[model samples]
Target: MKKSIYAAMLSGIVCPGSGQIWLGKKLLGWGFISVSVVCILVIMDQIISRAQVIAEQILAGNIGNDLTSIYAAVSNVALDASNSTMPALTWIFIVNWGLSVASAFWFGAQQDKQLQLQADSKTEA
Candidate 1:
């Protein structure tokens, strides 16, 4: 059980679904991995778009054509990007990854316990 848990946790480090795979839960692991990948890609796209918008704004002189305005605009972009994608997606990834590892461990442990109980019952019988 410990070995399974360790493997699952290790897999999570590589990708969210990896740990689930280690525990023989291929479908669950794949689901988690797919969701994580999609969320990450979406986050990246949003960040890139925000950066491009900021750049265009700078180029267009809409930010006062001054260093201070440029700095402020950059900061605003950073904040917006963080709010738009980073925080929410990061939380989702973390939760899914954690759940995958925890589920793998719990499943393995429960199976082991059940087998042990069955063996004890047979011995007693």
Candidate 2:
């Protein structure tokens, strides 16, 4: 019982779909991994590129270029990007993360039930 909860929590909170993988749900786990990879790569690349641009803006002394200014600029840019493919990417990320977490917990439950059924069958036999 404790192990099941721990595994589910770990999968949901830490790796998302890892619990499913632990339960031998390889297809779901790998699907999660692939989708997550794409979303994460896009988000990380965006962050790094934006950070570099912010740094350059600071170097160029644009609009005082303080942390607050940088934040505002980032928000504005993200908002602008929302009108493009950025929102789609962001939604993909959101949906994938949510699915991963849900899959982890759900697969954990399914695995536990499967084990219970097998144990009962063996006992009856």
Candidate 3:
């Protein structure tokens, strides 16, 4: 029920930086979102490029048109490290998400503490 919990869940389950946005930290949230989006785009670009290569092979008759042949080609392409930058991108994406979640939770907790202090001061007055 705490804002910190909600913020963390938003970032972890919804998307990176979503929690920061919920916590009114627009700039930080956007930074996390931008990094995540860029990583995703780059990864997708690599995948599409590999798909194109497979398609070309199919067209050139080097790969069969059957489902099994297509699967084999896809597997080969995915495992071909020389043709992909996915390994590093995947790690970056994961680390970004983790940082976003942690920051959102920390910011949310800080906000909650401030609110509590304000409330206590008002009660003392």
Whole-model lDDT values for every prediction: 0.77, 0.74, 0.93
**Residue runs of model 1 more than 4 Å from their true location after superposition:** 63-71, 81-86, 111-125
**What is candidate 2's lDDT per residue for 6-110, written digit by digit as tens?**
656766677766766777778888787788788889878877887788778778988465778878877776666444555677898778877777767776777
| Clash counts for the predictions, in order | 0, 0, 0
lDDT of 3 by residue, 47-124 (tens): 888899899999999999999999998998778868446888899999999999999999999989998999999999
TM-score of each: 0.70, 0.72, 0.94
Ranking by lDDT: 3, 1, 2
Give the best candidate by TM-score.
Answer: 3
Query: Between 1 and 3, whose TM-score is larger?
Result: 3
Model 3 compared with the native: what TM-score? 0.94
Better of 2 and 3 by TM-score: 3
Clashing pairs in 3: none
Residues 10-119, candidate 1: write the lDDT tens digits.
Answer: 65667777766776788988998898898889888977887788778778877677878878887877766436457878899889888877777776677677878999
TM-score of 1: 0.70
The residue ranges of model 2 lying beyond 4 angstroms of the native Cα positions read: 2-7, 65-72, 81-83
Q: After superposition, how far is residue 17 of candidate 1 from its true place, in Å?
A: 1.2
Clashes of 3: 0
